[model samples]
Target: MKVVAIGGGTGLSNLLRGLKKEVGNRIEDLSAIVTVADSGGSTGRLRKAYHIPAPGDIRNCLVALSESEEIIQRLFQYRFKGGELDGHSFGNLFLVSLMDITGSFISAINVASQILRTKGEIIPATTEDIHLWAEFSNGEVVEGEENITEYGKTSKAKIVRVWIEPPDAKPPIDAIAKVQSADLIIFGPGSLYTSIVPNMLIEDIKEAVEFSNAVKVFVVNAMTQPGETDSYTAYDHIEAFLRTTNLSKIDITILNTKMPSDVVLRRYIEQGQEPVIPDVAKIARKGITVYAEDLIGESQDFIRHDPDRLTEVILRAVSHALS
Candidate 1:
């Protein structure tokens, strides 16, 4: 099977961790189209200094698919403390250095992938030094991926819409090809506005998805993101995505049926996050199949998709795509 997963760091990387294990056996080809419009912390600083697309998410995805030794993986993830390089990740720095050496951002990623011995392909959605911009429901426009979320939180405004600058940024050569040939295309299980939607802002990438015969699946987040999907239900998540990006459809959606313990729930609620109510019947009514599963898993008291369970769900989605 040829599978493509699109989104940003953390959630997408978590998925890749499991999907990588399926390579060469159940899957013939796997590719990731990652958002590179991050404008926060180390990535933003590097992008400003180096005049290249954000490498942080790409770095995380590469490490997630990495078949390298444990130490090598750690080295890529390592962040310096209390120094000139205090906040920079080793992997981001490595990729940037290689960008200077290779004369292109994509080539740098290729070199890093080989060093990591990644199991599948990781491609940036665009190579342009780009920034994400969002208009709030309050009639204010904000630039920078992190700022949009933060602004929505502090100002108590929903994101009106989002778009990428340059408006014509191009995806890597293989990105569109992979999506076009893909048997399955997966979006999200990441920040809706910042991570996933940014990929759709690229013209050809969105068109490829619109035109592809691949079964499209959206892995809904189990819980709302405080600053982003503060009160989004399962239906709201899907609606927001399609509404914001103008993507044609989602064939299937996998929603988490399980919730965290009361103590955990209370803690999250305190911080303004909550379990996403999986409105199964509502989603199914839209001619989209809903697969509600017990996909809950905890990491350091935070709720996230269990990689193993998600991988299993993805394999099932693959069968649906093939059939």
Candidate 2:
């Protein structure tokens, strides 16, 4: 299968990490369409300094799919402490440096891919300089992804909608073609607004999805993101995802039915997050296939989708259809 996974943030990268193992077995080609509208942290600073698309998410995805030595991967992910470069990950700097050396962002990614020996291609959603802007239901418009999330969380205002600055940024040609040719396309398992939905804001990419034959799937996040989808049920996520992209429907929606220990839940709850209620029936009623499972995995008190289990489920779902 030629698979195309869309979105950005840790979720997409984590998924790619798992899916990488399936190459040549269930997946013949794998591609990630990453959101580059980030405007916060190291990525944001770099964007301001170098005028390049956000590279943090792309860095994470590339490392996840990397087939390089463990030491090399560690080096790429390394962060300098208590220095002028504090908080900037090594991978981000490496990409930026390559961009300077090559004089092109896309070229930098290609070179980095070769160095990392990434299993799959990591393509930015758009090469154009872009920033995400979100409008809150309270009639407030927040620019910059970090700012939007902060405003939404701190002000307790729901984000009514979001869009890119250019509003018409063109996606890389391969990105459009990948969506058009994909047998499987997955969205999210990440922040609904900042991570997944931003990719949908690109018109060309959204239109490509509409016309594709791919079995579109939206993997519901294991927990509610405080700033985005604060109390969203599984179906509410589906609603927001479709509404943002103008995609009529999703073919399948994956949900994590298991919850972590109360101690862990308490920590998230105190931080204003909660287990995303698996309201599977509502989504199922929409004629979309709902696949529920114990997809949650806890490590170091952090809740994440178990990559192995998630990948097995996804491939099994695809294999069944092909059979």
Candidate 3:
């Protein structure tokens, strides 16, 4: 199976980690198309200074796919405690430095992957330096991925549309080709608006996905994101994708059946978040096959999708699709 996972941040990274362990032997090709619209924290600083795409998500994905020594991975993930480089990750700086030396972001990533002995390929959705812009229903426009999330939280209106700057920004050819050739295309398990949707905002990437012959799967989030997806249900998540992209339908939608413990639920509720209700009927009405399962797992009191369980479910789905 040639699997292509799309999205950004920890969700995509975690998914890659599990897939690396489960499907690496079965499939020789696994590629991740990560969003690069981030404009906050260390990534933002590096982007501004060097005029390059965000490297934070790429670094995370590289480390997740790494098969190197434990110390190498730890060192790559190390963040400075305090000083001028406070909150900056060693991996991010290393990638940026490689970009400077190689004169190409893609080349820099290739070098980093070799250094980490990564199991699969990691590709950015676009090589251009881009920023995300969101327009709310109330006519408020927020620029930058970081600002869009923060602004969406306090706004009374819902996001009407989102696009990338330089509306004609081209996606990396390799990214589009990977989607065109993928046997399975996965979306989400990340922030809906900022992380996942930003990649779709690119015309070529979205078009390739819509036209792909692969079984398209969307991994619904276990919990609602406070700023971006407040009060969003499983059906709402799918609807948002349909509304934003030219894709007519998704083949399968994976919904988490288990809820967190009361204590964990309480903690999330306190933070203005709640478990995403699996509205199976509504989602099924859209002609999507709903695969509901006990996919929830806790990590340090934080509710997350169990990586191993998720991989199992996905593999089963792929088998069923093929059979």
lDDT-best of 1 and 3 = 1
lDDT of 2 by residue, 98-137 (tens): 9999988889999999999999999999988898988898
The 0-to-1 C-alpha lDDT of every candidate, in the order given, reads 0.91, 0.91, 0.90
Task: Show where candidate 3 strays beyond 4 Å.
Answer: none
lDDT of 1 by residue, 96-120 (tens): 9999899988889999999999999
Q: Is candidate 2 or candidate 3 better by lDDT?
A: 2
- TM-score (C-alpha, index-matched) for candidate 2: 0.98
Of candidates 2 and 1, the better by lDDT: 1
- lDDT for 276 in candidate 1 is 97
Which residue pairs collide, candidate 3? none
What would the TM-score be for candidate 3 when compared with the true structure? 0.97
Candidate 3 lDDT by residue in tens digits, 1-323: 89999999889998898899855476668999999999989999998998899999999999999999989999989999899999899999999999999999999999999999998899999999999999988899999988888887777468878888978889888998899999999997999989998888889998999999999999999999877888999999989977876578789999998978888899889988999999999999988888999997776577888888998898788779878
Give every collision pair in model 1: none
lDDT of 2 at 268: 85
